[model samples]
Target: MSNKNPSTTRIVELAKQKSFNTEKKVLDTIKSMIKNKKVINYNTVAKESTVSKSFLYKNTSIRKKIDMIRNEQADLKNVTNHKGNTSDKSKDVIIESLKFKIERLEKEKQELKDALAAKYNDFYNNL
Candidate 1:
């Protein structure tokens, strides 16, 4: 009941092939980005791979993989932050100790100068 010509059939076939190729290319790009430890968020991947954000969200497998990577990165960041806090605390303690030492040294230096001045005055008077 339809006049489907050979050229139209061939065009449809080529279009389908092109779409398949594009999808495959996008998936391949995503895998490569993951392997390279690149940021695997939806926006980043979509931008880098030239894939539509809607396609990424609609594909359940890709969406899940991206989510997994995102979660792993978040966990790593949290651990690093916790360790940094401990290091900061130690650094604070070291800074405080250095400040106390500087204050003690300044006080000692003032006392020595006063003693030296008194000794010089005594020598001048005895002369």
Candidate 2:
């Protein structure tokens, strides 16, 4: 007969059940995250899934999955960064357009001022 106490066996069984449930929960959480196209990283997964970072890092399978997904995302991130740089070019274009507008407005103001002065001179001469 096994020498283990009954209570000890019961406690061990409970611990095993809890561990299995936790593993399942973490796996399901990851699958759903992938489905939803959410960002997957150690910090994000830990925070979103309400699990400890150590737990995710410690589990061999989960660790591998996280590493693979993170690696794939790094490539996508580079592409996004490249697109975002166009904002700087757009800013330059906007600035040039505004400068052109200001120059045109200033010319119009000067013409109006000259016309006003000519009208005043004519009025005084006629008086």
Candidate 3:
């Protein structure tokens, strides 16, 4: 039981009018989804705008861009992890350097004390 509506077909035809190029329409659709804060499907856009789903997809497929974005995010995560590891390595190096400096200072102090005792004994015998 379909109602005979003449204006419905006309309305659908107007909706199918190409005011913008295929790529621009796809980009606009992406922006609209973001503005509405929801995900939209290409098939739905096709139903609304009367453009074929295959054609829309062929013109504005974001698979490559999405892949690149994912790769970039992974790289960022790796860099952050590397920086943390480097910081830990730097702290270890600093701790080792301070320990070496302390040991060297202690050895020098002991040498000076021994030299002073030897000099004092020789002077007392001579006097």
Report the lDDT tens digits of candidate 3 across residue range 1-127.
8768655877776656753465566566655754664434555556544567776656535434323544665676678664444587798988899999999999999999999999999999999
Where does candidate 3 stray beyond 4 Å?
A: 1-86
A best-first ranking of the candidates according to their lDDT comes to 2, 1, 3
Candidate achieving higher TM-score, 1 or 3: 1
RMSD to the native, candidate 3? 20.9
Error of 3 at 62 (Å): 70
- The residue pairs found clashing in candidate 3 are none
Q: Estimate, for each residue in 5-65, the C-alpha lDDT of model 2 and write its tens digit.
A: 5557788999989877887888888889989989899898888778899989988988999
| Tens-digit per-residue lDDT, 7-44, candidate 1 | 57788999889767867777788789978888778899
lDDT for 39 (candidate 3): 34
Candidate 3 displacement at residue 29 in angstroms: 61
Q: How many residue pairs clash in all the candidates, one count each? A: 0, 0, 0
Candidate number that wins on lDDT, 1 or 3: 1
Question: Better model by lDDT, 1 or 2?
Answer: 2
